[model samples]
Target: MQTSEYLTNFSAGIAPIPQDQWQALAQHCGPFLQYSFLNGLETCGCVGGTTGWQPHFITVHRHGTLVGAMPGYLKSDSYGEYVFDHSWANAYHHHGLNYYPKWISAVPFTPVTGPRMLIHPNADKQIIVEKLLEQAGRLEQFGASSCHLLFAQDFERHNACHAGYRARWSVQFQWHNYDYTDFDGFLSALTSRKRKDIRKSRQFLQASGICIERRGDGQIRPQDMAFFLSCYQQTYLKRSGHTGYLNQEFFEHLLKTLKNRLMLVIARQGDVPVASALFLYDDKGLYGRYWGSLRDVNGLHFECCYFQGIEFAIENRIPLFNPGTQGEHKILRGFEPIYCCSLHRLFASEFDAAVGEFLDREAPVITNYYHQAHNVLPFNATFRAQLISSPENKKGHF
Candidate 1:
């Protein structure tokens, strides 16, 4: 057999790559990895320059044909990445080392788990993934301290570990659908107490005259995005004292190119939208990415973000709903604890051994917490039994 030459190139953005070729591989990866969503991030100024996320998109070619690609960035500071590596950066600073400009393969601000090393099905999957990871870790050329692949999909986890990257684990709450027929069918799987609580919240919201409607694709008007952007920025300012990382430009771009994957859970009081939660979804799953409100209506967050998403998933037969990160409140609402993994390759032996030791110590703690959180889920006994036998739990995905 003749050997095929595989060529790889890293660029500051995906502009040089043909959009059709990129979209060919990205078709089913998810909304985050889609060319439009990522390129929109760069074009809208949500990432790049002083924003601390420097785009370093990687593309792999076979005989001049685009075969695989990875979205990456040269990070100056750990600001928008939800993986939380400031402690690692601080440790480096304490030891008289620089951690700034570490390379990462991720969806910039998105913490959702999806494909990182994307390859066409006809290509050699294992070799292409290995090639992509090996090239991504070539940080010495770029003066980066290390290379990390964040929120990587599970199939790539072993490939990464095989490529000499240390594995790190964290837990995010997610809701799963098991052939549910409707919203009430989902509630029947939960414990009596928790089921009643969800019912109570929904009923209360109904009586409060807050109409929650999901608008998507062409139904999303310019004013709707303007309102969503306003609520997003207001919430960010109230919580972090600044406008959010996203701007109107980003949402505008989304409306044009990625609107089909976008859904807005809007809460209105008599034709006036008060709060909005933006979600991205495809045939596979729904991701509750961003939400904000101009007025504080009781139980509005749960309805607009969680319940509505669950209902939509049931209607569309989507299998999963990942409602963002770091919310213990989600546990009581039936979101299962699932492990989200990141892989790292450090150039320096000292930091490699150090971070490896740190990860070794940290893994067990996160595992124990994941198991502990799973025990507290408000699922009924039968549902818990089903979950135990489900592939996600059987494979130790928790």
Candidate 2:
């Protein structure tokens, strides 16, 4: 396989690949290796240089056929990445070491778990690993601290390990779907207390005159996008020193290219949209991506992000809802803790070992935590028995 390095230029010959090619590749590679969803990030300038998500994508071909590809970035600052390495950066600063510019292979501003490497089904995994490793070596000359692969898939784990990268584990909460007839069927599976609690949380919006509505690209008006963007910005502004990476162009692209897979759930008060949550879906699963509320209404967050998503999944027969990363709040609401893994290849031996040790220590705690959390599901003995006894229900339990 011949490897080529494409620098982070948005308008170069190596422009955004066509959606058909991406979908074909993703189909050959599998569902999570989506092209339309990923390339949309570049075409819309969401992952461009201005956003500190400069693309340094890697492509490998054999006999003039695309064999393997990796969507990577020359990241200046780590903002949207879920793998928190701020402590490592601070440690580097204390030791007078440079750590800002690093290499990361991930979906920018997205923390959903999926494949990082796109390899043809017949491609040699070892060869792919070697080429990717060689690419990581380039970062050292550029004074990068490390090359990290965040939220990688299970198959990529072995190859990354062979490439001498350390593995780290993180947790995110997700709701699994069973063959429920309706929302009540789902609610019936929960304990009485939990069932009532979720019902009450959703009902609270009624008092605020905030009604939930589903709007797609066709149904969305211009003002609707403006309101959605406003709420999205508010989510970042509340946190000090935060800047949003995406712009109106990105949302516009999503409307154009991914309208069928997109759903914008809005919370409205007297015909005014106050809060909205954006979700991406396929036939199998629903991904709850970005969401924010204009007004801080109690229980609105759960209703808009979780309950609404669950209801949608139940109605549409989508099997799972991944509501971003790192929230214990979603646990009691029937979201189970799922493990997300990442692989890192640090340039420095000392730092590499340090991170390896850190992950070693962290993994056990995460494992035990998941076990403890698994016990906290709001389902009673009967519901639990039914859920466990049924293979389909068990599959949806995440």
Query: What is candidate 1's lDDT per residue for 1-398, written digit by digit as tens?
Result: 12258987897787678888898898989888888988899888999867999998888899888898988899899888888888888888998999888999888778898888889989988778867876887766898999888999887788988878899999999998878899989999889999999999888888888998899655887788889999999999999999888888999999889888889988988778899999999889999999999998899999999999999899988999999988889999988899899998888888888889999999999999999898888879887777678876643433
TM-score on alpha carbons, each prediction:
0.95, 0.89
Best by lDDT: 1
Each candidate's lDDT (Cα)? Answer: 0.87, 0.76
The deviation in Å at residue 152 for candidate 2 is 1.0
Where does candidate 2 stray beyond 4 Å?
Answer: 1-21, 27-33, 216-218, 241-243, 391-398
User: Alpha-carbon error at 262 in model 2, in Å?
Assistant: 0.5
lDDT of 1 at 301: 92
TM-score for predicted model 2 compared with the true structure: 0.89
